[model samples]
Target chain A: MTFVFRNNTIERFFSDGEYAFSGYDDYGAVPEAERYIWWYQVPVKYNQEQLITEVESYLRRLQWAVSQVGQAPFLILSLELLYDAGVVRGDRRLVNAIDAFNQGAWQLAAEHTNVSVVDFGAFLKQYPAAEWVDWKFYFLSQMIVSPRLAGAFGQWLQTQERALAFRRKKCLVLDLDNTLWGGVLGEDGIAGIRIDGDYPGKAFRYWQEAIRELAHAGVILALCSKNNEADVKELFAAREMPLKWEDFACMRINWSDKAANIRSIAEDLNIGLDSMVFVDDNPAERELIRQQLPMVAVPEWPAMPYLLPAFYDRLVKDYFAVYALTDEDLKKTEQYRQNAGRAQAQAAFTDMDDFLRSLEMELTISPATEVTLPRIAQMTQKTNQFNLTTHRYTVDDIQRMLDHGARIWTLAVKDRFGDNGITGLIIVTDCGAVDTMLLSCRVLGKGIEHEFLKYVLGQLKASGLEEVHALYIPTEKNRQVQDFYDKNGFLCTREEQGRKAYRLSLADWDEKRNTIYKIV
Target chain B: MEQKVLMVLRRVFKDATIDETCSQSNCKAWDSMNHLNLVVELEMEFGISLEPEEIARMVDYAAVVEIVKTKI
Candidate 1:
């Protein structure tokens, strides 16, 4: 349940079943909830001293309220000073007070992991003060904000919730002709393709620049077009295209069907198709993807080039927002690009030895302690594609598993580029059966999975285990990992109704560890 | 104008059976808060400024229509 704390009557705003709110300026109780949001508007006041004091007390109360909501996300909306600054030459006092309140929110967010400041000014500055607040409404219900803007406010708040969770579409599958640029590359030619010069071109250039920034924010940009690959490459090289050839992590710049191409892109990136958002100017291509790959989000392409800014804003807010990007997130694009290289170079290597040595990878396996339990539970709940058995366990469920003598090990992978922390896990029961085994799709395709399993198997052998049993439960999303155990030298003991069971004898186990991975 | 008012009233109150006879007295949904919404909607829909006096007096549907008609 999401609870919203407010200073004014915000009942009319969040009445869409998305949130439950506190009374006007009431911060008395912080009820047990999944999430909390502080959306205190500027108090309607004339006396400067009183208003300043009110702002100070409001921020102090906000800090106290945040302390009550333990690890659950507390989104503190920044206070925008809405009242008219009267005919004074310099009204610094009220401005400074509001600034302090806003800055205090940022400082509080910095101090607490759960607290995040959603800039209400970003939404408010778009409208005039006359439209932002209705005097009639204010007098009647103490609603600080105009009721007309409530829908937009509610939508913005929901986006904030998504941003805080770091839950967003990972990949943006873009169309080339008319989508990113003005004209078709095949007909308009490389130099003739509109990306730089005039009205439509300038608009498209800004759109491309926006997309480039999103890529820098760790969104994987990929191309899916019904154009010549050679021509597209030339365009990337020819004109000053903001997004060049290397910008895209994956590409389907060929004549294949968009649905099929998108599927290949998801496979290439090792992400679920659901994490991809398809953008195209052509409605037919979008409709095709919608019909074929319904899981993929195909947003309506903007009709005019000038609408690209609005389109980009909506796309980022809806698909790619994170409250605060982690160090790993900043380096995501570089990692995915490395995966692309790995995919290309995989066939050239004759054995796993050649590949492992080239990667120079390191694996850190740690037991699931209390500190790591939340992330482990989150991964178990959310990881779909690479998950084996698709068994979801909460932090409590994982603790219960421990009580049942299940040794859960989390694997952190780091290669030449950077570190991916606690991305994979293996849960082994007391009776020597694999309860859950999954890897983050980002860290897969490398023989790291084999190394992680071998390390866990070594731990089991040291613990005097004879045989280990594992199951491959079939799910619609986990079809890629059905043959995982079969490839890892586990003898299939039973196969029925798309569920495969495997058994590996520890006596016959080869303790041959990959030389490249320095397992911790 | 009537249709637009009806749209605003229905949307703000989440009601459908509202009409010319609808007033603050007849509609439980049209409380003080929603009365504010209805007034604001009428002002925006008619492209007019409602004075504090007019806003206070606008308590029913017929009163809203008359105020909006004069303003427009």
Candidate 2:
């Protein structure tokens, strides 16, 4: 049972039975409930200071009510002053106070793990301010949100609840030719392709930026196009588009079937086909994916390029709206990029050694200095999937480690594709124990992790360390690195509950750094 | 016009038993809230806004139809 702490008569907006409302302006002891919703809309008042005081008090009431509800998914609807009479009177204090209340609600949500702030402004912005509160209805009933919008509010609330549940899609598989930009790469040629000049090109540019924003928010972007791989690469290198080659988690730029390619992408990312969204301008290609890979989402492409903005909005709302992003979510792009590289390596390379060689990989491993402290610390905090010990450190922590004679090495990897900045790190204690070892997921699928470890071990061996101790501590996200030390020829000194303690002797073990990467 | 009124009444009250003879006195669901809902639905259906006095007099089904006809 969900109980709503509302200041106005909003029972008409929320559906019956599933929800019950408190008395008007009641902020007393919240009864025991499965869920709670705090939706206090801006009251209609003429006096500015009185309105400000009332609006500001709502935040305090909300804080008290939230304290009563013990971790039961408390949702706060942001305060949006619909009819601000202060605008005409040249008094902006009430408007600012309402904004302050909304900000306080957001801060409360940030502090409380169970609290989430819903953007009520997003719903209210749809209708005109004049239509927000009908005076006749307000006089008859204390309905702050117009009774006319009850049906829409209910639908919007449903979408908000679903967003809170976090069922958003993981990957967006895109077709490049006419989808990302205007015209075809093969037919239009590099110079002829429209991406930045006129109406259609401008529209595509706007759409590309939106997709790039989505990528930054941790949605994996994969390319599934029927075009020459060389042509696509050349365009990414030459064209100054918002989306770069590295932004895409994977790209299938070939004449092979798109459905098969999408399947390969899903497999490469270790995600289900249902979690992937496929976008293509070609109806025939969309139909192919729909029929063959029925689990993949295939949103209908707009006929006109100008209609893309609306289409993109609908796409995000349906597939990618989430209440909040976690650290795992923030690192998804780099992780997927690494996975995509591995997937591409599998398709492009017949031999693993040959693929590593083709990358012309260069690894720059060096001791940490003052300038590299922050980056190293950030890598430890953010890098989870491939971390051996899963130890998070701050800049000050690394500084203290350096003071105590702990050796730290930072790895920067650059290949034929592009430069991956400071992608790996290893911290060793003074007593020859591998304190923390982590590689950013962007550089993972390549045998770079193995090479990085071998090179670091070789350095420690050269420094006259007879043997070094290491650990593989288990975490919810670091399952891939559970057997990392075992695979690298470290003797398992102790093992329990997916965690392993290892000791590698430099005298017995041969640390052979692969010749594929030129390490300095 | 009578059919449209009956349709609005049936939908607003959520009762299929609503007919031309149905009035506020006879119907159990015809409460103050439903009365407002009926007014809103009728205004939307016929594209005509009813005055406050006209809405107060629309207590019975015949009075509702009579009031709506004058507005149209």
* TM-scores of the models, in the order given: 0.66, 0.67
Chain B structural similarity (TM-score) per candidate: 0.87, 0.97
> Least accurate stretch of 10 residues (summed lDDT) in model 1 chain A?
A82-91
Top-DockQ structure, candidate number? 1
Sliding window of 10 residues with minimal summed lDDT for model 2 chain A: A338-347
For each model in turn, which proportion of the native inter-chain contacts is also found? 0.70, 0.10
Give the number of colliding residue pairs in candidate 2. Answer: 0
How would you encode candidate 2's per-residue C-alpha lDDT over A198-253 as one tens digit per residue?
89999999999999989878899999999999989999898889899989887788
Clashes of each: 0, 0
lDDT of 1 by residue, A1-520 (tens): 7898987887777676666777777777778888887888888887777877887787788878988889998888888877764447586877787889888888888788788888998899889867888776777678778888987888987776666676588989999999989998888888778888888899999999999999988899888999988878877877787888888888888887889889977876778998999999999998999999999989998879999999999898778875556666778777777776666556578897787677778899999899999989989998898888999988999999999999999999887756777899999998999999999887876778888889999999999999999999999999999999988889999999999999999989886886788887
Q: Could you give candidate 2's per-residue lDDT for residues B4-37 as a string of tens digits?
A: 9999999989899878889888999999878888
Query: Candidate 2, A105: how far from true, in Å?
Result: 6.1
Instruction: Supply candidate 2's per-residue lDDT for A246.
Output: 87
i-RMS values of the candidates, in order? 2.2, 1.7
Kindly provide the TM-score of model 2 when superposed on the true structure, using C-alpha atoms. Answer: 0.67
Rate residue A464 of model 2 by lDDT: 94
